[model samples]
Target: MIVIKTMEEIMKMKQAGEILAACHKEIAKMIKPGISTMEIDKFAEKFMLDHGATPEQKGYHGYPFATCASVNDVICHGFPSKEMILKDGDIVTVDMVVNLNGWLADSAWSYGVGQVAPQTQKLLDVTKESMYKGIEKAVIGNRIGDISNAIQVYAEAEGFSVVRDFIGHGIGSEMHEEPQVPHYGPAGRGTRLKEGMVLTIEPMLNIGKYHAKVDPDGWTARTVDGSLSAQYEHTLAITADGPFLITKQT
Candidate 1:
């Protein structure tokens, strides 16, 4: 069933979202050449704990890590490993979530390590904008497809393909809720959105084909064509006024 959050619940989630945002901001600042992704994950875990929130992804469904550090061709759910080192000109994405007093907030962002390639930066720019384009359509009374289509149209026009295997989801007390928010579909289809419904709108765009193959670890997803990909996400609530990004700072 679709979970509708009360204003009180929304406020609690907003607090969690702020902590998640702060975690992402610190992670982004720490992204540079020579750092290991595992180090980043450790820092995030401590940061969340220090602020009274728990790192929700650690041990989630047997997954081992606080943050998913996907680098280059890795689309999402890339395991953070001490062996995985960041180098100059590499683009890495850090996806994370924080649970504060039973409320949850999730978000992801791709960062450039050192100076990246020009085309790679374009891919990142387009992917981030595509997420915002989708968010712009997440208003009350609109179908979820409206948000999906907005992302697809802009990404495709920019010469990128939206990853279909992994889509966004509704987030509340539990991490994943009802009404899967896809990133590609027709504008008029899918469930009609309503106020108080909180969901995540994450668009994963690839510089090449959308086909993704999972790694042997069964978590990390990589582009089949070995092309670079970018992703951005925001947990949002459908308000009477419009869509409010819960993960954004006030």
Candidate 2:
């Protein structure tokens, strides 16, 4: 069953979302060449705790890290490790979730570590743009597929492939909720979006093939051919006005 957030719950979720957004902003300032993904994870854990929020990803289904640091070729669920260090020309993705006062906020961002190749930069640009395009359709009366279609169309037109294995999802108290959000396909199908319905629109686009494989770690996922991949995400709420980005301190 779909849960429509009440005014009070929405406000609570907004506060949680802001905390989640701030976490991402904090990582952006701290991430650079030579830093290990584990270091980033530690920062995230401390920040969330200091801010009175819990890192939902930590201890989530045995996931030990507070942040899922996905480097180039790793799509998502990349466990932060001391061995994985950021370097020049690499794209790093940080996916984090914060739970505050029983509410949850989830978001992700892709960054170009140090200086990246022009083509790699373009991939990052396109991936981020695709996320925004998908968010444009997160309005009342639009089906979930509308958002999926926007992402798929914009990304494909940019000459990139969309990962079919892992998609975005509804997020709330349980972390993962109803309405699985795919990043590729036609609009006007799938679940009908309604007011107060909140979700994450994460588009994982690959510079090579859309296919991916799960690493032996049983969590980290990378490109099947070990090519570059990028992703961006935002927590969205379908509202009477339009799609409201709850992560915007709303």
Candidate 3:
């Protein structure tokens, strides 16, 4: 069943969202060349803990990282490792979730390490723009597919493919909830969004085909054609007014 958050619950989730945004800010400052993904992960965990929140991704379904540091062709769920170091021209996506007082907020951002190729920068720009396109449809009365189609249309028009294997989801007390939000669809289909509903509209756009392959570690997902992938996400709340980005400090 889809869960509609109470006013008080939404407030709590917003607090968690603030902490998550702060965590991402700190991680962004540390994303330059030479730093290991594990180093980023460690600092992220500490940042959340020190802020009186918990890293929701740690120990989630046996996953063992505070942040998913996906690099280059790796789509999502890239386990942060000491062996994985940032370098010039590399793009990394840092996905994180924070739990504060039992409420959860999730968000992700893709960063370019040092000086990235012009093409790679374009991929990042389109991916982030697609996310906002989806967000624009997250208002009450709009179907989930509206948001999905918005993302798909904008991304594909820019010559990128949307990932089909994974998508966004409802987020509240738990990290993943009901009403899975896909990135490509026919608008006006799927669940009709309503006020009090909270969602994560994350679109993962690949520079090549949408096909992906799982790594031997069974966590990191990479593009089948070895093309760069980028993603951007925001946790939002549907209100009578419109979509409110809980993860962004307004």
Candidate 4:
């Protein structure tokens, strides 16, 4: 069943989003070369705890990390490891969830470690833009497919492909909820959005085909063609006015 958030609940989620957004800002500043993905995860976990929020991703389904640090060819759910040290030209995506009180907010951002190749930079730019395009359709009276189609149209036009294996989702007290939000689909199909409905419109774009392969660890997903992948995500709500971004950064 799709849960419609009350204004009171939405307000509580906004508070959680503030901490998540701030954590992302701090992580952005520390995304230089020489830092390990595990280091980034540790910092994120500490920041959430210090802010009186919990790193919801840690211990979730036996997942043992505060963040999913997907680097370069890794699409999503990349394990943060001390051995995987970042270097110049590397792009990493840090995905996490923050729970404040009882509310939950989730977001993911991709960042370049240092100087990146022109093609890689374009992939990042297009992926981020595609997310915003999807967000534009997150309004009352719209269907989930509207948001998905917007993202797919833009990314495919830019010579990129949207990952089909994983997609965005509704988020609230639970990490995953009703109305699964895909990043590629027919524009007028799927669940019809309603006011107070909150969803995450995350578009994962790849430089090659949309196919993905999971590692033996069963968590890390990488591009089948070994091409770079980038993603940007935001938890948003369908409001009477329009879409309100819960995890929007200043």
Candidate 5:
């Protein structure tokens, strides 16, 4: 069932989002050549703990990391490895969830390690803008497909493909809640959004086809064609006015 959050609950989630957003900001500044993805994960875990929040993704379903650092061809859920050293021109997507007093906020941001290739930079820019397009459709009385179609239209027109394997989801006390939110679909279909409904609109766009392949580790997903991929995500609530971005950076 789709859960409609009360204003009080939304306020609590906003607090959690503040911590998550801040953590992402700090992670962005540290994204540079010579740093390991594991190092980024460790720093994120410490930052959350210091702020009295928990790294909800750690140990989640046997996943043992504070962040999923997907680098280059990896689409999502790339394991943070000490051996994976970042070099110049590498792009990595850091995805994580933060829990503050039981409220959850999730977000993912793709960062350039150094100067990126022109094509790779365009992929990042298009993916981020597609996410915002989707967010714009997250209003009361709109269907989930409206948001999905917006993302798909924008990314495809920009010469990118939307990943079909992993889609967004409702987030609250639990990491995955009701009302699965896809990034590509027919507009005006799927669940009808309502005020107080909170969900994530994450668009994972690829430079090649939308197909993905999972590694033997069963968590890391990468582009099937070994092409670059990018993603941007935000947890938001449908409000009477419009969509309120819970993970909006200060």
Candidate 6:
């Protein structure tokens, strides 16, 4: 069933979102050469705890980490590993979640480890702008597909393919909720968005094919074509006036 959040619930989720975004900023700052992804995960755990919010992904559905550290070809759910070290010119994505006061906020961002190729930076910029474009479409009087369409058009313009295997979802008291939010679809299709509906509209764009294959670990998702991918996410609410990006102070 689709759930509609009350204003109070939205407020609580906004707090959760702020903490989650803060985690993303800190994680972005830590993505340098020589740092282990596991170490980044540890810092995320403590950071959320210090902010009085729980790291929602640590034990979520057996996810096993505070954040998902997807590096390079790993599309998503790339486990943080000490054996894997960040080197110059690597692309890494960090997915974050914080549950505070009975609500969950989720966000993700991809960044360059050091000086990267111009084309790689283009991928990052396009992916991030696509995320915002998707969020801008998350308004009342629209269906979920409107947001999906915006992301698809924007990504395709940049010559990136949107991943089809995994889609975004409703987020509230639980990490994953109802009403799947896809990143590629026709506008005016799917469920109609209404005020108070909160969701995570994440677009995973690949530099090559959109197909993905999961690792044997059953969590890590990687590009089937082995091309670099980028992703960005925001937990948003459909407001009476407009869309509310719940994962930041603004």
Compared with the true structure, what per-residue lDDT tens digits does model 5 show for residues 12-97?
Answer: 99999999999999998999999999999999999999999999999999999999999999999999999999999999999999
Candidate 6 wrongly placed segments (more than 4 Å): none
Collision pairs in model 5: none
The residue-level lDDT of candidate 4 at 107 comes to 98
> Which structure is stronger by lDDT: 1 or 5?
5
**Which of the two candidates, 2 or 3, achieves a greater lDDT against the reference?**
3
Candidate 3 vs candidate 5: the lDDT winner is: 5
158-202: candidate 1 lDDT, tens digit per residue: 999999999999999999998999999999999999999999999
Q: Model 5 residue 9 lDDT? A: 99
Where does candidate 6 clash, by residue pair? Answer: none
Cα deviation at 117, candidate 1, in Å, is 0.8
* TM-score of model 6 (CA atoms): 0.97
**Superior by lDDT: candidate 1 or candidate 4:** 4
The candidate 4 region of ten consecutive residues with least summed lDDT is 136-145
The TM-score obtained by model 1 is: 0.99
Global lDDT of each candidate: 0.94, 0.89, 0.93, 0.95, 0.95, 0.90
Candidate 6 lDDT tens digits, 82-194 = 98899998999988888887789999889899899888899999999998899888888888899999999999988999999989999889888889999998998999988
Note the residue pairs that clash in candidate 1.
none
Residues 1-250, candidate 2: write the lDDT tens digits: 7778876777788888898888788889877899999998999889899999988888988998898999999999998999998998889999998899889888889999999999899999999999999998988888889999999999999899999999988877878899899999898999999988989999999989999999888998999898999999888888888887878632
Give Cα distance to truth, residue 206, candidate 4, Å: 0.3
Model with the higher lDDT, candidate 2 or 5: 5
Candidate 3 structure, TM-score to reference: 0.98
